[model samples]
Target: MQIQGLHHAQITIPKGREQEGRQFYCELLGLEEMEKPEALKGRGGFWLHAGNLQVHVGTEDGDARSATKAHLAYEVTGLEAWKETLRAQGLVPEESVPVPGMERFEFRDPFGNRVELLEVTEDPSL
Candidate 1:
């Protein structure tokens, strides 16, 4: 059997802190906000569209903690420009090791969630 692409990614935020999640994911990250289904609206969360990926934030039952094991990565066209944009928003972008064949950088979301910005090389074999 073959699996298709990702349908959505879910991140858990502390209960009653949906607003904080919104500020970081939406306001800081510049992800376009999308409305969630009516049935899931009462669940306390927000949906965002990141390119072809859908990011969903759900409220966790307890305290919020950093997601150190997993992270979401985005491929951008202009790496330097995007890095500057993030810096202007008061977010620091850290230089990351060259992925075997990709140029990438890493940064943390307002909630300390790790994210990577990669620029695909013309020749991926590089």
Candidate 2:
């Protein structure tokens, strides 16, 4: 199975500064704010459209961006096949927080950066 492309990349801002994050990314950068999933609404963060992909801005207590839970999400065609592939490579994939219409897992890369593989089961925007 092949990865289709990047679905989204995440970055984090300091906790309780969501409004500043929105003003910077949405107003200054001109990215349209996208609705976060209903289940995730209470989580203090936001999502933005960046051309064909998305950028998810989350909150963190303190640290450099990479030290937080920021990650890159890649869209893949085969959900189960990817799990098998990662397992064969000896990497344990951790189940992600459930998002409606998507199946996903996260694993740390060799250098310790978080990477997520996701397959869309339905159009989440619908």
Candidate 3:
């Protein structure tokens, strides 16, 4: 068997700072917060759902450092709209990454997690 697609992307947040997550992921990013399972209810953090894609923010030791090398990439339809939303929240896209066949940019979450928004265009050879 082979893997079909990515299930979720787990990001880290400082302990007891889940409300920040709600503000950023839910309020700003427009992701819906889902209830944690019964078994995992005691654990810290929250779950966000964008359609079928999931983003899990878990609590961790407080650190000044932010995620640099690792990041999550999301496929989006309204790229310009998303950028405007990010700017409206004062979380402007850091820099637009140049990919030959794609339009994309990177932005940091409130907790300092890097997320890439991508828009793929049709291939010439159809």
Best of the candidates, TM-score = 3
Index of the highest-lDDT prediction? 3
* Pairs of colliding residues, candidate 2: none
Q: List the residue pairs that clash in candidate 3.
A: none
Worst 10 residues of 1 by lDDT: 60-69
Q: C-alpha displacement of 9 in model 1, angstroms?
A: 1.0
User: What C-alpha lDDT does candidate 1 achieve relative to the native structure?
Assistant: 0.81
Candidate with more favorable, higher TM-score: 2 or 3: 3
Clash counts for all predictions: 0, 0, 0
Candidate order by decreasing TM-score: 3, 1, 2
The sequence of per-residue lDDT tens digits that candidate 1 reaches over residues 34-113 is: 99999999989889999999988877674344647477898878888989989998888999876766788988776666
Higher-ranked by lDDT: 2 or 3: 3
Error of 2 at 89 (Å): 46
**Candidates 1 and 3: which is better by lDDT?**
3
lDDT of candidate 3 over 1-126, digit per residue (tens):
999998887888888998888988888767899988989867899998977888888898865436376887888889889999999888868667587778889988777777898888767466
Reference-based TM-score of each model:
0.80, 0.51, 0.83
Q: Global lDDT of each model?
A: 0.81, 0.75, 0.82
